[model samples]
Target: MKNELLSLLNKNLLAVEPSLIRKFDDEISKIPGIIKLTLGEPYFNTPDHIKIAGIKAIIDNQTHYAPNRGIVELREAISEYLRRRHYAVSYDPQEQIIVTNGASEAISTAMNSFLGEGDMVLCPSPAFGLYRNLAKINGARYIEIDTEDDKYELTPEKLKTYLDEYHTSVKMLVLNYPNNPTGVSYSENEIKKLAEVLEEYPIVGECQEVCVNG
Candidate 1:
């Protein structure tokens, strides 16, 4: 019998290509004495302190479902950390902040909330691959501004040019620091310059990207 069960699945999912990163890992693992730099994983096991905390939490019966947004204390700690790091931003733990399982899940939650049918996202090319798929998953499209020629950095002039050419159809911008793949980051001045350009798009929100410099 034909697999009629396939028809009940999401049509959009059919178009998603397998993750290139994972495929690259599988092929590279077959090569003898090859160090696979493409796959991102820690070189060390979990720290002893973290392991102790987990054991303590489990013994204390703290392994229950958390609030939908996340635990309030952890959310507050995140908010404080962002502020202390001179991001100059503050979010309320009770509402604005959410603790997700990982960066990918956070991106999904954010995109699902922000993107609607046919909306567009602007991302610099040669970035982390997940951003492109996240936009598509949310029923939106993404415009990858190729940054290969610019030494893997997105400039304010480039952003302005694209925004002008596209005439405001772009719904969001994805900016990353210590960006994946290229491993280049924006200087404080460079970020300020980009912010100046973005001021014109005051209503545009929900810029999605991952930051993991640590």
Candidate 2:
């Protein structure tokens, strides 16, 4: 039966492994009073106001699927938040904003929109595994740039070396800032160095940053 099920699975999933974090957490969960947050197992409860608002929404028959980009009100609020935080340029809610289930889905969605069969996606490893999975699911290739030797982040010199070696076209490059599980971030000068390397390439990327939920 297990063999038969495997035959029906997507070919792209054949080589994919379940998340190591999730697997370890599941194993430890059997222990008495074990708690984990690596997979975002929240230890806190939902706030009362949020709970009441959700209940009220359900009672008002608001359970229908939202717009493809999600609720305009929420999107607008997010746009405002980004502006308030001075992360980047402010976006128009109706024209630019989207509300995703979480950062995972958001990455999948964006990759699907930009990647196609035989496309190449440059992703630095020692980060989330989902980025690779999403690339496979989109019929694109995931080029894992090992960043262990480079301090868990891609360096400009390494980027240049890969680019020179490949000379192969890249459809997209995924950079996860304030990365998950490690919470590694780039300083201003480090970012400048990376930008200098990328300046040589013709790249088209949306600058909107997705906050990975944990």
* TM-scores, each model vs. reference: 0.89, 0.82
| Candidate 1 residue-wise lDDT, 70-131, digit = tens | 98889899889877885767767787788898877886776677677778888887877877
Candidate 2 — which pairs collide? none
Give stretches of model 1 more than 4 Å off. 85-88, 202-214
Please report, in order, the local distance difference test score of every candidate based on alpha carbons.
0.76, 0.75
Best by lDDT: 1
Per-residue alpha-carbon lDDT of model 2 for 1-214, expressed as tens digits?
Answer: 9999989988877867688988888788888976666676577898999999999999999999899999988998899888887666588899777888876677777877887778787767766778788778777878878888877887888877876765366777777777665677888798778778766775433222642211
Clashing pairs in 1: none
For candidate 2, the per-residue lDDT at 54 reads 98
